[model samples]
Target: MVSQPHIVFLTETWLSNKIPSSLIIGALPYTILRFDRSSRGGGVAIIIRDYLSYSTVTLPSSEHEITCIDLFHQSAYIRLCVVYRPPTYSLSKSESLITCLSDIHASSPHPIVIIGDFNSDSLCTHPTPIDRLFLDFQISVDLTHCHMFPTRGNRCIDWIIANDPSLIPTISIVPPFPSCDHSGLSFSLSSPQSPSLPSQIRDFTRVDYSAFFNYLLSVDWFSLFCDCPDIDSIYSAFSSAIHSAIDLFVPYRTPRPPSLSYPPHIRRLIKHRDALFSKVHLPSVRILFDQCSKKLLFEIDKWTRYSTRKKLSRVNDLYRHISSLTKPKLSIPELVSPQNLPVFDSISKSNLLASEFASHFTLDDGCLPSLSSSRVPPSLSLFTFFPHEVYKSLRKLSPTCSTGHDAIPQIIFSKCAYALITKEFQSALNCVFDWTQCNQLSLSASKCSHIRIGSKQASPWYSINSTVLPLENNVRDLGAQVRSDLKNSSSIKMRAQKATSKMFLLLKALPFNCPSILILTKPMFFHYLASPFWNPHYSSDIATLEKVQHTFTRQLFYRCFPSPDYPLSLPSYSDRIKTFGLRALTERSVIDRTSSFGINIELTTSTPRYHSFPVRISRWYSQLPDSIRTAPNIRMFKRRLENHPIIAHLAKLT
Candidate 1:
């Protein structure tokens, strides 16, 4: 089913009405119909691929143990049915079954395929009264049995009887499913062909960054922005410059289509299994082939687990691996309109999502009082941006930061900031909300969010035009969450929870059959699970992060080394972490992250009155040794600390 067969049918499914279709199929792209028995056991189901147009057929009441679907393929309709009859059912039932088939053959204006377990063996060779009746009916209806081999126990009890023999070329029987007696059958249907579609391709690897930078350097900044009267004009010019550079330096080429290839181990296993199946026909040899098939399946499962574990061992690689493995999620949160009606259509749903987001950030126009006088500074009105100053500011911008709503890179605004652009930017924003005829732009109120750094009482409400903007406790900016309290506890907790979930998953997925491999992979797994939380530039309470790390480490240790005598002389948690060659989430490590960001504490004239991450980091930095304190920069200081391991350890103690 995962390989996406065109159609599937099952008999003696034992599925009851109580079982939902979602539980049975679960997001597979298929339309299903089932005929469940009133009592326990003996049921049938038919599923057709979603790409094919299909509908349920209203069968006669005589077809009690049957499920049927009509498939529309290439301007022609085909009736497909699945039937199941228990061995305990009376021979008289065959009369109704034959009548149902006769009626279907007469009524359907298309080819018919009837596949099922009839519980009658060798009907063509040795016929009972009911078997002889079916044989006579088959001759009259021009039906042919497609199954050449026995479906179960040296008897052709199951069948694929089709009205048009040309529809099916050949039927191949595979081994029986685990715990099932009947063999699985596969057949290819002749269908109309369609032309292949060409796909657009881009090769980003050929981009020349050096050429791009040179192009950027050659652009005349003064000529572009000197006469620009508004922020929009300046933004337009900056964007044009970057885009032209990209167009010149980045080469776009269409490459040949990619070929699908399996992993080497899986390919080898498949080849081995095929060789065994092709050469061996003896009963003992067939059994060996079946065993080989099972072994191949097991190897594939093990390889998948091993590959997942290996990729998840690195924090940077975990997201990509998880994304590739994740199934398309169906449980989207339902959106409702203001009138309490469900939004189903894509356009309405999008509008609802936007409205919901706006509701969170928007405040009533009457919530805040208007200002009595002009609040804009006198000096800000005369401030003009210089090209040189803008260039310097842009250089300070982080290359990795994301682009803004205008599709302009953050570096552009960062560079613009050097020439007192903040005042101009605010003026431009105000112009957009002035509601005058000249107002050519409008900002999305929902997309904009603000966080107050001080006490709520001290903070004043902000508004664009008459609409007051809602205040937030924390808001994500430049890829990191900035909080009013400036503590990373919330961020750290989120990371810890995510890591803990992945760690538990790893524990559950580890193969107990290979303990040596598990032992070897433990350190890699630990690093993969824990590194993301600590690597990012965030400040968390050391004790809190340590507790989270400790919990995960303990669980991992117990799973990897599950011996009764192992903890008789219980070692310290830190010692156990060392034994596993894993790094501990210590207080010093947390402080070091802040230090790496070039935060200086000794420069502070007074102790910070408020408890914040920056204040805490400053305090930690002031207490460090002079060698670290007087280092040229954050990177150099980090390198020094890395070199003097004993000194760094002692510094943590302080």
Candidate 2:
């Protein structure tokens, strides 16, 4: 007897980066899950190996259902449930368990396996209605205990219960310790088989042939042969027929136990049967070829009269159709015939008995059970499990462009700024130079004009519009005076100049690490943020706004992109964009929360005050390296105004 593999489960662990990485062993391939319920903390997770793939499910607020996927194949499905029963103190503990199981059984196909800490032991020691209901529910669902741990000790609270006894579990309890309240439970599956195959066989030589033949003679064949008088004579005279029929109908014989080893002839026969079963029985390749060949011959004849193109097409089509019939038809034959007979022969000794066993048995490793003794359901609720608001904001900040190309905002900003610096935009140069304190020689319109003659030179403005009394030099002098007036006049204005750190502000407020930003960023990130003005579609005002936004944000991200060792976290709303199937901008933006952090800059109202400012962290941040300095100031400012309950949230974000 060979031992079957195991399916395990466990959960409710609040995993953090602080814990050492350890592999869950004893069974192969362990699954680990971590979910925090809310900011306050209450989440459910499960780990299962094999059995089936896992998915998330959502339950109503009042219900505590073990949400999982239900895949149905024919009459049965492989169902595993990972349950997290809150400590006995919660009011709805039993209701949660019952409702969860009810939903699972109702929605999923069975045979079902529920593994986890139920926090209850036995019916005799049952502590709550939910535990009692679970027991009754198991009974109602026809579930049985193939095995349980601590069978002889105090009542078994932790369990691996399933709908089918054939799917019973073998459990090992991990010793309890002072650190954790509950003991770790491990479970394995038990092989479902009878001690041996039915040992019945039949023999033909000892049967009474004459009596059997006489019985067949009483059937209504006389009517069909009424017109042929020779039929009665043939039946009455056929002695060979009786013997032939008797040889085919042998009595069943009880098989004796099989020998430990096979004779050479028996092994050869077994191999022969296996080959025949593969080629002729299961796929029945020989039979398919025979049938397909006949069909093809008919099709060729039928399509031969069509035009040349038509004939060719029809021939190809028929060939493809005939080919398709081969695989499926062959599969049925292969499945019906027994391929491995020797294994059965070793168990039953008799060749005939082995043959019978081979016809009935099939081999499958019960769809790989879970690694831990815990039962893990297939699906979980994506919306409920992940942070929704933060994810939404990230989606807004990073979006697909009209052409569905990734236009990184930072890249766009850099390009625009480089262009402004290189291009001969006099106004732009004037703005930048004045702001930067680079006061140098200034060129007026008059200084830009010059003309030459045979013996003398004169200003171009005077040469073009001339009068003797109003000399060319005097006209140039007047033009120079006008240009200087424009340059120095207090009335001449500049585009409303506002110093903003909005882009940097957004970067500082990112809820998750930079990696999350990378994940949510799309080509549209560049299109809207970096080149909004370059798009002929928008007015100059809009374009200028876009330029400022792009410049600041691009620089911010370029400076703060996380180091390789420390990856950034994804914003919560990104889950909606990727996993929830919400793809459109309108859908993403309406509920987006990360918008404020997208560009990190804000416009301030023009106000003047004569008041002392508080001595705070902002002053401290101004002293650090230029790289991390701005981020700290923005963070400190935000903290001063609104103290977020989550302290050092950025640490978690990374």
- Taking the candidates one at a time, how many backbone clashes does each contain? 2, 61
Q: Mind giving the per-residue lDDT tens digits that candidate 2 earns over 529-628?
A: 3221121111343334334434443343444453444324422333434432333232221112121221322222221111101111222223233343
Q: By lDDT, who's the top model here?
A: 1
Q: What local lDDT score does residue 383 receive in model 2, on the 0 to 100 scale?
A: 20
For model 1, the superposed segments whose C-alpha errors exceed 4 Å read: 1-4, 14-42, 122-124, 192-195, 199-264, 278-281, 300-654
Tens digit of per-residue lDDT, candidate 1, span 266-293: 7876777667755546788878877877
Q: How well does candidate 1 match the true structure in TM-score terms?
A: 0.39
Error of 1 at 329 (Å): 9.5
In Å, residue 559's CA in model 2 sits off its true spot by 29
Report lDDT (CA) for all predictions: 0.63, 0.39
